[model samples]
Target: MSSTRSDVSVLIPFSKRNKDQEEALRQCPSVQMSDLIFSDIEEKETLLDYVQRVKKLVTEENINIILPTCDLSTMVHAAIARDFPHIPGPTVESCYLAFHKAYSRQYLDPAADLVPYAVVDLDSPTMLQDAERALEKVGFPAFVKPAAAQSTFGVAKVKNYQDMNRALQNLRTMRDEHPGFKSSPSAPFFKDYFKQYLDVEKYPLALRDVVIVEPYMDAEALYTVDGCVVDNEIVRWAITDEHRFDHGDAKFGQDLIAPTSNVRRLTEAALGCL
Candidate 1:
């Protein structure tokens, strides 16, 4: 807010093995960014540790905002926002709400004109059957993604039984390997002898407990409305053209113009209806 603090510091997870990290480093302004990564050589620098470290750095550096763009970072960002008041961020809870398809849908009227969704319980023995039911309810070639996911990392559009089965299996496997999936103390994976060989769950139960089956919307032209909430009001808003060409030719068309006043109003109303 001041001339001395005019520069905004953005903290993002970085890794040498990641091409995105390399690209980000190359493109980012030298004085306006900080990268944090966990390494075996860095004491107490686990993924969770990296999150806390970044938050601390944000405070010390007087960062204006924190934007978490990935699943891991978003989870950490939400946790810090929900638990710690010291962390500097805008509407972490709102972002957290957006992270889950099920919760996001809760705030909306079910009968509203929007995409359809079905909830598949994770602990059910007839899990596949439930998924199939959801498919039947939503119609074929439906979008399937972890209800708690951010990106289209595990998303798929299945048209038939075989593809559906394969997708279900893949999602189940993903849940198994999730770092946040907790094993029972009595479970074999938790036993002292086998613990070392176990893989941590990648996401927490809040994310992995349910699956969202939806009729994918046509977003050939997509745009993201970025805003900052201050004093419980949307103080500053900007429109960015969403572009994602890598994740299965899913390009966010920048040619699509930002929503005009009437369109913006409709979009906000639609978002409210989830």
Candidate 2:
């Protein structure tokens, strides 16, 4: 298909409402645009519910493409993309491997120097015990984060056993408070979704329940690339270097600048591995 706006029906999923996206679509003039409510797995609405709702909207509205602006929405759209071929994003398998930290670690199998980490499954009855073991292996000055979460929701830096325990306790409290869908099978819409991508017996813990313990890196800069794969070819779009505000214990992105060729190539090499 041509890259013309007239030939595409784009659907963007937002956590609440986004006036920016609406304004961007208005400027386009020829594109068909719609919104899909973005639901967190920890929220009252389940992932299945969100996907089913989106699938129905796509069918009724004839949405030809999904532009997932959030991590949760990316996974949701990727899961259902098989039914709707025009969604421009990663495949279901790739999304599962990439979005889930633990699974991605296993799939990528990065060099020891690149990533030294261990996965802890919170769904297990012995999660605390497993975490303790992981702590011992990863040692002090490490990070504990949910395997499939985004926006640094369940991320913490721990320096000692006491800190690790406190972090784990906080994560457990969050999980207890947010208990996701009681049963996936009970939701008829999830039948096909599960059959296509899920194997509960194999991966006992859901993606969200998995956690990773990894050594902390005191990095001075962060870089990212925005790209896509079309016709089995990787296309580079843009690269930017992220500047962050460091506040003793935490860091947040403050600005982004287009990097030079050398930095862009380095970032491209990293993306190639993925």
Candidate 3:
């Protein structure tokens, strides 16, 4: 609430890549910095544990604001925003709806023209039968991915039933190794392994339990809009044209270019629908 940066104390969760982020914030000179241990949602921690930890940290440090820089942190922060109203981010409901691909697809179904034809809740007992029907409807070259994951962790492209089965097998393997997905809460964390499974019943509202299958649109370029909504107003920021590697299936961004007028207008219109 203070106009001067000297009065502002920021609490950023410690991440592996926080060095660059910390350096960036330190450039402001007057902003007080503090670190909160970053907790992965899909790890050993329960919803209660995560909330208690963050609540304790904010209360003890008297944090003025929270800026979540990753997907896991954003979800946790949004869920506990009522405890710290000074934090600037989306509401818990909005974050849940947006973070879960299946939920977002269903929510935006009325505006169906904007979304790709997709099937939801692929982790059910009738998954094979449902997938066969969905594939018939949506056609081949479809994408199979976890409903709530980051960095394309469990994402795969399936051209046929064989590819779909293989992708599903890989996902199952990931789930089996997941700490949260284990039968017991006492399971040890595998530091070298990355898990992408979410316990649906335990954290139903905050986490996604299923996978989504959607028709993949071949686009000339991929664009992303980065912005914030303040006081119910959508603020437009930079739109970047994402460049991808052509060599393999590793779908990582190679470069970014500022959007043109046409791309900007389209991105704004898409944001308006949300």
Measured by lDDT, the strongest candidate is: 2
Clashing residue pairs in candidate 1 are: 178-201, 178-202, 179-200, 179-201, 179-202, 180-201
The candidate, 1 or 3, that scores higher on lDDT is: 3
Task: Give lDDT tens digits, candidate 3, residues 1-274.
Answer: 1232344445544244455545645444334444433333435665445556777877777765565654555555664565567655456666656766776877885845764555544356877777778788778788777776665566677889988878776776676667454221111221111122233354352332466788866666777776566546665656767655442443534465765444333222222212
| Per-candidate local distance difference test | 0.50, 0.60, 0.55
Candidate 2 residue lDDT tens string, 1-274: 2233444555666455566644544444334334333223434555666677878877877776666644556667686577677654566667656666777777674555455789876657887788889988888789887776655556778888787778777776766665553321112223344555677455544433567899877787767665556557765756767655565675544465765444333222222222
TM-score, ranked from best to worst: 2, 3, 1
Q: Which scores greater on TM-score, model 1 or model 2?
A: 2
lDDT of 1 by residue, 1-274 (tens): 2122224344443222445543543343222333433212133243445555665765666543344434345545554454456455434456545655676887687789877778776667988899889988988767776665443556677777677778777766765665333211111212221122112242233423567788755576566675544445663344655434434533322233444333332222212211
Kindly provide the TM-score of model 1 when superposed on the true structure, using C-alpha atoms.
0.56
Q: What is the lDDT of residue 140 in candidate 1?
A: 76
lDDT, residue 157, model 1 = 70
Ranking by lDDT: 2, 3, 1
| CA deviation > 4 Å runs, candidate 1 | 1-49, 52-75, 78-87, 90-92, 109-111, 175-207, 218-220, 235-274
lDDT of 2 at 226: 55
Name the 10 consecutive residues with the lowest summed lDDT in model 2. Answer: 181-190
Ten contiguous residues minimizing lDDT sum, candidate 1: 184-193
